[model samples]
Structures are given as C-alpha cells and as structure tokens.
Target: MTQHIQEAYGYIFEPKLIEDLCIVAAELDFKEGDQLIEIGQYIKKMPLLLNGVIKIMREDPDEGELLLYFIEKGDTCAMALTCCMGSSKSDIRAIAETDGTVLMVPIEKMEEWMTKYRSWRNFVINSYNNRLKEMLLAIDNLAFMKMEDRILNYLKEKSKLAANNTLNITHQEIANDLNTSRVVVSRILKKLENEKQIKLNRKSIDLAL
Candidate 1:
C-alpha cells in the first residue's frame, strides 16, 4: 500500500506476479514486543516487512542476545536453508523491536517466482549469499580483532554511511550489534572518549576524528 512497498515489489517482480503473489500473501499487523516467529517453529514463508523495524536476534543465556540485523520496510525475513536442512534447527523469530506490518508469502510461491523470473531469482540468490558473508565476516572480526580496533572500525564505517560524524546510536545498541556486553562496549567507548576519538552522550554519540 505504501509507495516504498509498491516500488520494492516492482523491483522484485512484474506487476502481474505481484498481484499473484499478493493473492497468496497474508498481511499481519504486529504490535511492539510481538514474536513473529519462535526459534524452532515450522517457518514456511518469508515475511516482507511493510512497516516498522524488527530485530532478528539469537539469544545467549549467558551473554544475552546477539542481534543479527534489523529488518525494516521492504526487507525480507526468513531462514530458508535452515528450513530445508531439517526441523532440528531453532525456529528463527522476528521480534517487533518496534511495531510493524508484514506480508507473509509462502516459500513455495517464492520458489515459483524464482523459477519464472531470472532477475528476481538472481536477486534472491545474491541476497542470501550476502547475508551469509556478512555473518561470517562479523564472526571473524570478533574472533581475531582487538577490542579497540573493532570499535574504531565500527565508528569509521558508520561515520562513512552516516552523513556526519554524529551518529545517533546508543552504547547498548552498539553492544548488541557487536555481540558483546554493554559493560565492555561502555568501557571501550569511555576509553575512546578520553582519547578524543568520540564524544559520548546520553541517548546518542557524536563521532570525533
């Protein structure tokens, strides 16, 4: 219904395919804190985020939750290969980190579309590969890199993407993305601030050179 939805749909499929896909896709409005999928549930469809942000997180009883990524409007959430492997895998869950709407499209239809549309098929393949590579790279960085190096690298990359150095991010949020404790993140940030690398503040951080 939103302009972005229409635009993204156009990129993924022809108008008629979108119409057919919509026939099978179910729309759901979720409130904050809603669990769209539970880890280990029989996930049969990919949900297209229509509104709001959802965090795809895996929890650690000891370290807390590790955030994989946030799925915003026009993003898709589904663990396809995990489903194909077997039901032994934990059912992936999409938590409404904030309230959102989703279009649940059956996996079968997605496969059908991939077969019918070369461009869309390539897009899905690339997306899956990219996500996998990002996950692997994150793990490698965490395992081999020093704390200060990682923090500085994170700031540099974020600063580049962000228009200015004043990236509106919280220490807690950074820790979740980095797969570490807030205490560790705060400690590193404090060190960086003392060295004039960044200015820390309540609710957000200002990037410093």
Candidate 2:
C-alpha cells in the first residue's frame, strides 16, 4: 500500500503526508464499468487514482450523460474534492474506465490535511483548476466542434488513455459518452473510415490518423 502510494503520488505529496495517507486511506479495487460514484449520492470518501483510468460524467435529466473528463493514475477528482469540502451530494458520476486501484480517503481528512499539509492544499487547488479546464474543453467541444470532429477527438483521447491505436469499444458506448445517437455515431464513423482516418472493426476501431 505504501509502495503504491509512493509510486502514484510521491512527487506531489511530501513523505509525511504520504505516510499519513497510507495510515488512513482504504485501498479499493474496481473493474471496468464499475460505478465508483453516482449522481445524488453523498460522497463519503474521495478517490485518489493509483492505476488505470476513471471517467467523470455529468447527467442531464433530458439529454442523458456527457463525459466530462478522464482521470488517470496520480489524479484525483476535483468535483469529488468540492463535494467533500461542502458535504454535498455528487453531481457527477465516476466510473472505472479500466480495472484499477484507488485509495479511498475519508472525507474528514480532506479538511484536516488541507490545513495540515501544504502539499495537500496545493494538490487540491491544482486539481480543481485542472478539472475546470477539462470541463471547459468539454463545453467547447459540444458547442463548437462538429460531431465528426468531436468523435475523432474522443477516440484519440481514449486511444491515448489505453496507450493503443486500436480500441475495443462499441458504437453504442461511444454514443453514450458523447450524448449522441448510435445512428449518428455510426454514420460519422463510416465517413471517417471512408476518409482513411480510422478502420472500423467488429466492436472495435483502429486509428489510422
């Protein structure tokens, strides 16, 4: 556990703070598609990613869900930090993008560490800033980018996260994440394939660009 903490966050957190985290943090393992946090659920623990990826999403009562951003190893959810600070319910859903491990730190320790450790405070602030930027990028994509461009960018991001050009994902999954229809996704994907940007496969896509 200590080694995991060191590997994930040693540079961001001081040795003393890391030791404290190791003492209080509970290790959790999650599989792909596991719902780590849900909308309207009260947050009890803040997740610090140890390995793999987690996708944060926002729900719309009428439009379904939109993917906000992806948090990978050494990252923490800024929205989760906000909920922890306010003692509020989660407005976003957090799902495991891959089989991963995380350290679940008690909410009470959030404030305590903020006051006690400068590194923790800095990390919290930086996380909030980073997440805000990602949210803005998501908004920009939705408001300005064409569906095809958005789909390509989304695939590129997924590919980068998976560290592979080929992605084992379906059109429906892409539609859900992008908050669009499967028909639209399929059409755009076909266009992309025709343009030699990506190769369509059975339940997978191979990037050519």
Candidate 3:
C-alpha cells in the first residue's frame, strides 16, 4: 500500500502526507463495470485512483444516466470530494471503466491534510477546477452538438480511454452513457459507418477517425 501510494501520488503529495495516507487509506481492487459510488449514497471515504479509468455520471428521472467525465490513474473525483467536504450524499455516480486499484482515504483526513500539506490543498483546488471544466464541456456537448457528432465524440473518448481504436462495447451501453435509445444509437452508428468514420462490428466499434 505504501509503495502503491508513492507510485500513484508521490509527486502530488509530500512525503509526510503520503506516509500518513498509507497509514490511514485502505487499498481496494475493482473489476470493470463495478459501481464505486451511486446517487444518494453517503460518501464515507474518498477514492484516489491508482490505475485504470472511472466514469462519473449524473442521473435524470426521465433520461436515465448521462456520462459526465472519466477519471484515470492518478486522478480523484472532484464530485466525491465535494460530497465529502459538505457531508452530503453523492449526486454523481462513479463506475469503474476498467479493472483497477484505488486507495480509499477516510473523510476525516481530508480536512486535516488540507491545512497540513500545501500539496494536498493545491491538489484539491486543482481537482475542483479541472472537474468543473469537464462538466462545462459535457454541457456544451449536450447543448450544441448534433446527435451523430455526440456519438462520434463519445466513441473517440472511449477509444482514448481504452488506449485502442477498437472498443469492445455495444450500442445499448453507448445509449446508456449518452442517455439515448439503443435504436437511435444503432442508427447513428450505422450512419457513421457509412460515412467511413467508424467500422461497426458485432459487439464493438473500430474507430477510423
């Protein structure tokens, strides 16, 4: 656990902070598609990603789930941090995008480290700023981009997250993330394939652009 924390956050945290984290943080492993945090759930611990990707989502009563952004290795969810600081339930859902490990830091330590370590304070402020920017980008995509374009952008993001052009995902999964219908996703995907933007496979998409 000490070695893992050092490797993941040594540069961002002071040695004393890292040492304290290894003492208090609990290391956990997650498989792909695992739900780490859900809407209305009280956050007791904050997660620090050591490896892999995690997708943050927002829920709507009528539209289902909308993908907010993805957090990768060495990143922490600002939404989760907010909930921890405010002592409130989580409004966003966090799902593991791939098999990964994370260090769960107790909420009590969050405040202590803020004043105790300069690095921790900067990290928290930067996380909030970065996540806000991503949320704005998500809103922009929804408000301005066409459906086909949105689908293409979504695929491109997934491709980058997966570190491969070939994505092992389905139309329904894309629909769920984008908060659309599977039929609509399939139709737009087909259109994209026709436009030579992507190649459609049985349960996957090979991005060409």
Top candidate, metric TM-score: 2
**Per-residue lDDT of model 1, residues 54-75, tens digit only:** 7677777687666565566656
Per-model lDDT = 0.70, 0.96, 0.93
Off by over 4 Å in 1: 2-4, 31-34, 61-63, 78-91, 97-99, 152-170
TM-score of each: 0.74, 0.98, 0.97
Q: Residue 9, candidate 3: how far off, in angstroms?
A: 1.5
Predicted structure with the largest lDDT when compared to the true one? 2
lDDT of model 3 at position 92: 95
- Candidate 1: which pairs clash? 39-91, 40-90, 40-91
**Model 3 TM-score on a 0 to 1 scale:** 0.97
lDDT of 2 by residue, 1-209 (tens): 99999999999999999999989999999999999999999998999999999999999999999999999999999999889879999999999999999999998899899899999999999999999999999999999999999999999999999999999999999999999999999999999999999999997999995
lDDT (Cα, tens digit) per residue for candidate 3, span 120-146: 999999999999999999999999999
